[model samples]
Target chain A: MRAALAASVLLVAASAAGWWLTRPPPEPPKVAEDQTFEDMDRAEYEAWMQELGYTD
Target chain B: MLLWLAVLLGMRFGAEHWLPALAAAAEQLDAGESMPVPPKPTGLASLPAPGTPGDGQRATLLSPATCEAMVADLRDVCWQSLARQVAPADPDEALRVCARVAGSEMVLECHADVAESIAVADRARAETICAAIESRKWRGQCFFGSGLALAETDAEYAMGRCAHAEVYQTFCRHDVVGEIALVDLPAAHAQCAREEGDWLTRKTCWHGIGKYLARRDTSEAAAACDASTAEWRGTCYHGVGWGGAERDADATLADCSTRGPYADHCRHGVAAQFKRADPTRAVALCESIQKADTRARCLDFVTR
Candidate 1:
């Protein structure tokens, strides 16, 4: 009876070890949601246009 | 015995408990937190000493603080070199120094500042610098800078002339044109008209003259247009026709009559005018029309 109990415990521990060893690494932190690219105004647009020599 | 075997196998496979225990023992010995210390980064020992020849030359070699210091030193050196040699007694030497320094962004900015200072000290020196730079491959920059300097010094004609130069046209004609408009509209119009073969130049010239006319006398505007080429004349007549049509139909017709190839357009415009003024007069005008299209358009105008 004691031998059978020991075998069951051994199997459970073996499975846990296997699962832990094969687990994927933790993911990196997420970027902030507020970051964006759409942020220029009309004056900035005109300045760029002038720099590029567009008259109209 | 089975439980012992399982524990040994588990340790062989994967376990963090042993790591924490070892970390705790180490920290206890060292009297610190029970956390594993990270190893030093690779290549830290290979770096040269600060202020050494190769220490700050490359970006990757310096730490952030050291990099900032190196950049500051480089900027100071560049400024000193620019101030010293950018205004050499010999024009050619000054140009050579400026060109050499222009390779660096900081030095190029310094050179510009130094050039402005020289312009203020002696206008002749500024012109000489411009002439010297004109011979270099960077003639466009030379012309643009000189034109701006001259414009600032109240040399309107010279500024316009410089703007019309090939180098200035390539780099800054649009900007120069704006400055020219504020200083001398007639000169600007003349310059643009002279470049008539180029469609853009012709259009810009016509537009400039048109704006000038909007605020000036009609006779002056007419003279400006007359001085232009055939294409510009057409443009002027078209503009005047639009403006006149809005104010007076008869005046629009008269303005359209001044240009040919547009005679059909003029006839139609006049026919519409007459219809608006007097339908009977429009029908009478249509009677003597030669072209079938013109006559048909005139009849439609009068009937409508």
Candidate 2:
């Protein structure tokens, strides 16, 4: 009876350890959206032209 | 005891499953070691109520008084920038940049600064900036400011006309002809005559004489006409006839006949006036012109 109980305990411990190791790691934090400096440059250019008498 | 150990290990594994997630949540929430809190977006949040004093269709974040103060500040900056720059390599680009500064509400304090900068950089560029400002639809302030700036520079009469026409028209009619006294009227008249197709220039020329005529009697009006170029003389005679002298139809015909080229047209115009005033005198004067075609036309009118 002592031997059977010890074997049962070992089996349960092995199964739990296996489950923990095999499970996927939590996903990494999501990357924030990328932005470009060019958008600001273009906006500045448009604003400049509007000030100058080039209506188009 | 073995079963209890197995249960402890299972609980440990379950705890392990949630531990990383819990750690991440805590990290995200943590205000971590003396770092400043990010400022909230108060600009958007603190916007004034709709329809408030400074919040109509043309509402700006700055009040009018605030904008004026900013404009004054910009004027100083503009003067400083202008002093530093000798010339702009690209006048067109400079004009564009200056114009932009002039128009932006956020940067409006920079408008006068930009204008002064352009003036120091390139006078032509400054004019271009003013012209651009003048062309916009709702341009009361822009037009007046730019117009005054342009007047300081030497643009053509047309540009001056464009600049002054809007504002001057608002308060009082612009005596375009009267303004010509301050300019080279003959050259301006010729330029206008060339650029404006049809009879617009002729009309303007006639209108312009009202200023000179206002100071003169009929003889001086005639002498001024005589001293004028042939085209202008013709116009001057026409002006005289139109300016309350048409009652003496025969005299107008005699005066205008001396101008030649337009003589036939003038004769016909006088004849029409005479027919209105005294048909008999018009028939006699038409007969005296000795052109058979003219005489016949005159007789036809008298007969009619």
Q: For candidate 2, what is the lDDT?
A: 0.39
Q: What lDDT score is found at residue B129 in candidate 2?
A: 47
lDDT of 1 by residue, B218-271 (tens): 344455556656755544433333323435555555655554554443444344
**All models: lDDT?**
0.43, 0.39
**Deviation from native of the Cα of residue A16 in model 1, angstroms:** 47
TM-score: which candidate is best? Answer: 1
Kindly list the per-residue Cα lDDT of model 2 for residues B258-282, writing each as its tens digit. Answer: 6455454345434544554465565
Question: Taking the candidates in order, what DockQ does each have?
Answer: 0.04, 0.01
Candidate 2: misplaced stretches above 4 Å? A1-56, B1-195, B199-219, B222-236, B247-266, B278-287, B290-304
Q: What is the TM-score of chain B alone in each candidate?
A: 0.34, 0.28
Who wins the DockQ comparison? Answer: 1
True contacts kept of each: 0.09, 0.02
The regions of model 1 sitting more than 4 angstroms off are A1-51, B1-113, B134-137, B152-157, B160-171, B184-187, B193-197, B204-304
Q: Write the per-residue lDDT of candidate 1 for residues A9-39, one digit (tens) a residue.
A: 7788775654344332222122122211123
